[model samples]
Target: MPVWGWILIAVIVVIAVVAVIVARLVSSRQRTERLRGRFGPEYERTVGEVGNLDAAEDELAARERKREKLDIVSLPPEARAKYADSWRTVQIEFVDNPSSAVGAADRLVIQVMRERGYPIDDFDQRAADISVDHPKVVENYRRAHSIYLAQEQGDVGTEDQREAFVHYRALFEQLLETDENKDKPKETRA
Candidate 1:
């Protein structure tokens, strides 16, 4: 081959390689942004836990995939209202029995999840699945579960029990919200 032809071929190959590299970098950045936006703080926490960006993103992506297979649905207005009433009762009980109230709250949250088509066989798995749609409150769910565990040991104080109730409420409220009733007055959400 002529020298000029050889040089031209080499330049072409280099440009192709550079283009591939640029395309890959752009793709990686876009994936990161999409996952971060969807998961919110859960994205940061998972990355910190896994200590690798790719692995954490993969885990979060898996949650999305798993969630897609589930039959999660919003509660009907009547059911939503009933659960809200139950939650109010739990809160009222918190005044006299904070520890028991925390336990009731935990059970209530799980019942809501179960009724909404989320699997409740395991807490960790349940949280992972919930994180897909409710990233902001999954951490709250974790915190509340931890508190519930501590409460079972009788090592938690009233304040901690109250905190757990609040966390459960966060997740509960999110689960209760749906497009059909989001704009309704709180009293009529049921």
Candidate 2:
């Protein structure tokens, strides 16, 4: 090819590559921001739910029906398990698997709690001195309880499934270490 033709082709390729990179970066940044907003709340919710297994199961069941009815929550049982397991892991951090960290779960939990009059504060102490017996806390516990139960029936992959389950377990255990809920006094002890 002629020198000019080669130069033109090179320039076009460079532009295309740059454009793709920029698009990817922007997309990733938006996702990160959304996730950042939810992390603390999700961890907190997990902690509260794991502290009370029955309530968590009930909460999971309710969410499952809502998601299915809406037709917007279409994850495979495995994926749902991943999510539930992740929450469980967030509740009790162990060395088995990783956490299923999704922004939607965080946002949904927050919105539901807010609607139920749950007092959600920032991660710090100044946010809110909430107790388990508080109305909001009770509501949150119920929500988490149901969601956790729905996840119990999930199937894991032969290799990856085990890892995923392990990760979920680990995530919950890990959450316990930094469980903000621990700071709150348990009223019902459920």
- Which candidate has the top score in lDDT? 1
In candidate 2 the C-alpha lDDT for residue 185 amounts to 23
lDDT of 2 by residue, 84-161 (tens): 555554434322331232223343344433433434464221112222213233334333333433444543323433
Off by over 4 Å in 2: 38-40, 43-190
56-154: candidate 1 lDDT, tens digit per residue? 999999999999999999899899989999999998999999998899999999999999999999999999998888888889899989999998988
Measured with C-alpha atoms, the lDDT of residue 151 in candidate 1 is 86
lDDT of each: 0.88, 0.39
Highest TM-score scorer = 1
lDDT of 1 at 16: 100
Clashing pairs for model 1 are 77-190, 81-190
The clash numbers for all candidates, in the given order, read: 2, 32
- Candidate 1 stretches greater than 4 Å from native: 178-190
Error of 1 at 122 (Å): 1.0
Residue 82 in candidate 2 has what lDDT? 54
